[model samples]
Target: MAQKSAVAARAPKKKASSWQKRDWVAAYIFIAPVTLGLLVFYIWPFFQNIWFSFNDVNKFNMSTFVGLENYIKLFSDKEVWKAFGNSLKYVVITVPAGLFLSIFIAALMNAKIRGKSIYRTLYFLPSVTMSAAVAMVWKWIYNEQMGILNTAIKAAGGSGHAWLTSPSTALYCIMLVGLWMTVGYNMIILLAGMQGISVTYYEAAALDGAGPIQQFFKITIPMLTPTIFFVLITSIISGFQVFDTIYMMIGKTNPAYDDTQTVVMLFYRQAFDYGYKGYAAAISLFIFIVIMIVTVIQLIGQKKWVNYD
Candidate 1:
């Protein structure tokens, strides 16, 4: 009994199997490159941009810390205010418009219809196409002379005006292009969300004398609120940061440039064109602050409307 008790008192330490170690090694290997890229590219540059914002930076990257001088200049500058307002207008128009159109189209696409696959592919093609190419195509379409739109207007006995050269219409033209490009992607996202919903709820609603429109509002929309919220947040961010399409379609020399200039475009012009790197950095930081505040507001507001259940 004493010998057995002594033997039982000595316990062997357990070790992880080689396979477990191998699994951990594989996981780290898979994540290493992404981690390194984020650190070197995103994280580092973000901090550098913040540092540069407080200083007067030169082309050679030399800087003198000027505290809030750069920010002060930006706040006082009429051009900065104009560009910020333009960006805000862009967000206001595009975000809600894109969300509404996308939800509407997605609902239609989700319905029982022929050629649904083809319609989906056609809509998604714009998302895959390069934005610059898309912008160029739209630019020609909006050309003052010999453009398809102008040709159509002429055929209808209406005067053909330069759509992109007039301040009143140029921003709207840009917004339209953004809408065209964005609707498909958001539609697909919403369609996926709609598809994820159980059909039983819809069927039950149908059995309860609920019409299609009624089913859509009472069942589909409520269940799809989470997806809508996701798309809304992303759309707001993208809309606020709109630059490429505007830059490609409305060149710097365009008469309506000032009216259509987005915040990012203004930042580019200030940083690269005028060589005010510090001021540009400040502008970028301001944009970051705006986006952060808006996103936080959305997050807080989501509790009221974004239903996960």
Candidate 2:
């Protein structure tokens, strides 16, 4: 009996049946198109862009090997630094401001308020609107002469400065527009996260003599940290890549172009306008590196603050 049991234990497992093999084949077949599409469109282009960064690529799509030359130029380029500073400033200012506003609005929306649906729809309108259209509308609103803002200032017997043309205010104006366009969408996301928290927590807090504000800080905020971290990551990335609004609102000839130009705007100018594809590729790589670093740092930092439970 012991010998027979040993032989049974040593027996080879059965091979997968033909039906199982067919199922595996079918699964791969179903995924093949999407996989191929990613390889062709995203993965290939990413590696190609990296290769382009090391070469001197011209307007004619010709490339000549000039390893590290573009990267060296990138480091020494003043405009690149300026653009990077602007982008950094954008991220620094907008991410926190946007997060605060989003949280505040989300908290309000989460409350038992009348016309909540209507308020949400109204706030969300700008996020769904075309970015170019939003930029154009905001550009008009900040127009030096006949903008509603200026008109209101004039009515109040105060002079209106050129909002989008002034170096000091142009970036801030664009930031405001960005905040307006994004706040509603982010609020919606936060609201969903808020709603997912168990009612038992709030009830428990109430029984412990915790008021609304105390409960918010002690329980709600802690529980919502994961969602907040997600928002922070995405918002920082978006802020750093700000382009459409700056491009649409401030022209190449605009006085405040330098002040408002982000890394992406600089990349666009180099790649398309100036025909420095290689240098543009380098700029793009820099952007990718910066975003990657920021994301990695956030991922590490989240271990301390982001509450999964």
Candidate 3:
């Protein structure tokens, strides 16, 4: 009897029913590469960033640990505060205006028209085209004296004022370019959402003697709420991250730089140019907090406006 039991045990318990063993093997294979990569790259580097944020960050030697002194200095720094204010201004100017403008453009593009494909391609071209090239083109377009904008103003019997160089209009000019660059992307997204709505809803409204304007407010706006909500959230996040355009358009020595510098731009200058890694880390953390708070508030408010079904 003991010999029979030993033989039964050695038979492998029916081989885990096949499916169980296969599942285990498949899971391991699927996760192995991701697990290894995360350990070597993301997981390791994330800890190192945290460590570096607490240390003095010396160039070729061991870094000394500092407490909250870096954070304290950040709160008192005027330039840091200025950068924060500028970032807020940019978000205020861009987010709402951009969302509305995108929706309006999408509505216009959705209308029955000739060469609709060509019009769509033309609009979407900016969204897909290289940002570096776009910046270079806009730089010339916003040129203080010789730009197309100024020439147009002159031809229209108006004074050709400074565009990007003027402190008064520097940030606005950048914001306008950003708006133009992103409008097509937002329009395309909104248009897709609009198209997904059933034609029966519009037909019903028309049968009820509703006009185009009435149908838009009653049907189109309500149907497009989810898309608008999504666009708002994404646009706000991207607006906070408005750095590349500012860095490209406004040089370090430019007089308008002071007015247009953003939080990320300040973080870059502090971390690299001035070698204030800890302080930069503190500013970055604060910016993260600000973005989180703003996004949460917007999401909460969206509950009142955004349609789920």
Candidate 4:
């Protein structure tokens, strides 16, 4: 029996070849840079942010451990709530609007029309434009007295209002700019997803006497689920982290700043401007938790509808 077992074991069981091992090694080598980058840049910073959040760090040093003192201050602060509220409001108003418009534009762009490339390029312009430049241009356009938007309102026989300067409208104006710049980016991604879908489904739908609208709702939308999910997640992530546009457009010292600022913007102000590093870290940590919660909810919900091809 022992001899029989030894023969069975030695009957040249197929091992993974050296070439396969070499290929795996080569792939790991190629991925090493990105893996190392994540470890150093992302992972380390993440842990450090958490550590800083719990400590009474100052300008010169990570001086003392305060153990949730910063967090306590965050809860009792009215300004923190204002900034957080602004961020939540921005997310609520922007996400759905952006998602709908992006999908609509993407559908239009996918159509076989004359000058399609030109249209795509035109639509994508805002995405390529720098945020600083866009903010500067929009700042001029939102000028209370001389801006083109107010001038247009006056031309249309309507009252001229301070768009960005007004607390009532400043956040909305910021949202509008965000919508303009990003809608096309999401469109591009959706368009790519549309391209990946096989036309046979559409052809099949047509053969079944389905109209274009029916085909879109029943076939296109279902197949595009994964893409929509990706776009939605990314947009939410970006919207929550918004800062530069708010800073440049709203101005740090603007009267409307508190109403238009985000949590991240608040963090920046508290950390760099006020030299409250620990407080900023605490705010940052809260923002991180909120983002994580949103993302996890989306992931859980997506399991029901995200179609894989």
Candidate 5:
């Protein structure tokens, strides 16, 4: 009887039920498209880019292994360094300004106000608008002669200056457009974070004789730090890759083009205009490195300010 009991205890476990197998199969089927897309579009291209960076690729699509030549050239390239500096400048200017503006707008919108949905829709419209269209409209608005901006300036007893044509102002002009485009989206994200905070905290602070400003600093900001961190990281990443606005607003012929050209713009010019695909690939890798380093630094710094609780 003891031997039989031991045998029964050691009996093979039952196979997984048919229902479990079917569930797994169904999940795989549901995810197949996205998995395949990532493999083909992102994973394959990423490896190919790395391979191309080490080779000299001609217009015929033939490659000759040149090893670190492209990378070495990048260090001495004046245009490359200028582009990098411009990209960093854009990030420095836009990220903080955008963050603060979004938070301020979100705080205002979070208050009990009339036509809140209308205001949100109006603000978010710029985010949904096509980039190309936004560029065209802003181009008209920044036109040196007839733009409304210049018109307004002249009407105010001030001289009108070329916003997109002058080297001193072109990059900053593009940065303003970028800020206008992004602020609404970031504001909505912050508003969601604001709404998620429990009213109890604010009520408790109010009972403690905390005014609105005091409650905002003491209760709202601490809880919103996580969302702020997320927005900050994403903004930095996007700001570093600024290209379209510069490309559209400051074309190659424009005198301000050099002042405003970003790293991606340099890549575009190298790959297509100059037909140096390998060099372009190297430039892309450099951009990837910059973004990764910045992201890592922000991640490390977040622990000081981000409140996961």
Candidate 6:
């Protein structure tokens, strides 16, 4: 009996049936299109861009191996540094302001207020609006002579300065528009996170004699950290890549163009306008590296504050 039991234990397991094999094939078939799409559109282009950065690519797509010449030029370009500074400033200013406004608006929307759904819809409309349209409207609103803002200032016995043309204010004006465009979307995201928190936590806080404000500070904020982290990362990335509004609102001939130009704008000018594709590729890689470092830092830092529980 012991010998028979030992032989049974040593026997080989049965192979998977034809039906199981068919199921595996079907799963791969379902996923193959998506995998191929990513490889063709995303993965291949990424490696191609990296290769372009190491060569001298002209407007005609002709490339010659340059051995980091493009990268060396990138480091020495004053305009590149200026554009990077502008982008860094944009991120530093917009991220905090946008976060505060988004949190405040989301908190208000989360309250038991009247017609909040309508209010939410109204606030969200700008987020869905075309970015070019938004930029054009703001450009009109900031017109030096005929803008409503100037008219209001003139009517109030105050002088109107050129808001979008002055180097001192142009970047800030763009930051304002960015904040307006993004706050609604961030609020919606934070609102969803706020709604996901359990009612039991609030009830428990109330039983402990905590007021609404206290409950908010104690429960809502902690529970909402994960969403806040997500918003911060996305906002920083968007702030760094600000291009459409700047392009549409500020022309190359504009006096404030240098003040408001971000790194992506510089890359656009080099790649398309100036026909230095290889140098532009290097700039693009720099932007990618900066974003990656920032994201990695955020990921590491989130361990201290982002409360998943």
- Which ten contiguous residues of candidate 1 have the minimum total lDDT? 300-309
Off by over 4 Å in 1: 1-18, 306-309
Q: Kindly list the per-residue Cα lDDT of model 5 for residues 256-291, writing each as its tens digit.
A: 889999999999999999999999999999999999
Question: Given candidate 2, what's the lDDT at residue 302?
Answer: 96
Model 6's alpha-carbon lDDT is 0.95
Q: Write the per-residue lDDT of candidate 4 for residues 33-77, one digit (tens) a residue.
A: 999999999999889889888888888855589897999999999
For candidate 4, the lDDT comes to 0.90
TM for every model, in the order presented, reads 0.93, 0.94, 0.86, 0.90, 0.94, 0.93
Better candidate number, 1 or 4, judged by lDDT: 1
In model 1, residue pairs whose N, Cα or C atoms come closer than 3 Å (at least 3 residues apart or on different chains), thus clashing, are none
Measured by lDDT, the strongest candidate is: 6
> Mind giving the per-residue lDDT tens digits that candidate 1 earns over 85-169?
9999999988999999999999989999999999999988888899999999999999988789999999999999989999999
Determine the backbone clash count of candidate 1: 0
Which runs in model 3 stand beyond 4 Å of their true positions? 1-47, 306-309
| Lowest lDDT 10-residue stretch of candidate 6 | 300-309
Clashes of each: 0, 0, 0, 0, 0, 0
Candidate 2 colliding pairs: none
Q: Which residue runs does candidate 6 get wrong by more than 4 Å?
A: 1-16, 306-309
Clashes of 5: 0
Instruction: Give the C-alpha miss distance for residue 115 in model 3, angstroms.
Output: 1.6
In the range 1-309, model 6's lDDT, one tens digit per residue, is: 999999999999899999999999999999999999999999998999999999999889999999889999999999999999999999999999999999999999999999999999988999999999999999999999999999999999999989999999999999899999999999999999999999999999999999999999999999998999999999999989999999999999999999999999999999999999889999999999999999999998898555444
Give candidate 3's whole-model lDDT: 0.85
- Residue range with the least summed lDDT across 10 consecutive positions in model 4: 300-309
Clashing pairs in 6: none
Residue 274: error of model 5 in Å? 0.8
Q: How far is candidate 5 from the true structure (C-alpha RMSD, Å)?
A: 3.3
The positional error of residue 5 in candidate 6, measured at the CA in angstroms, is 16
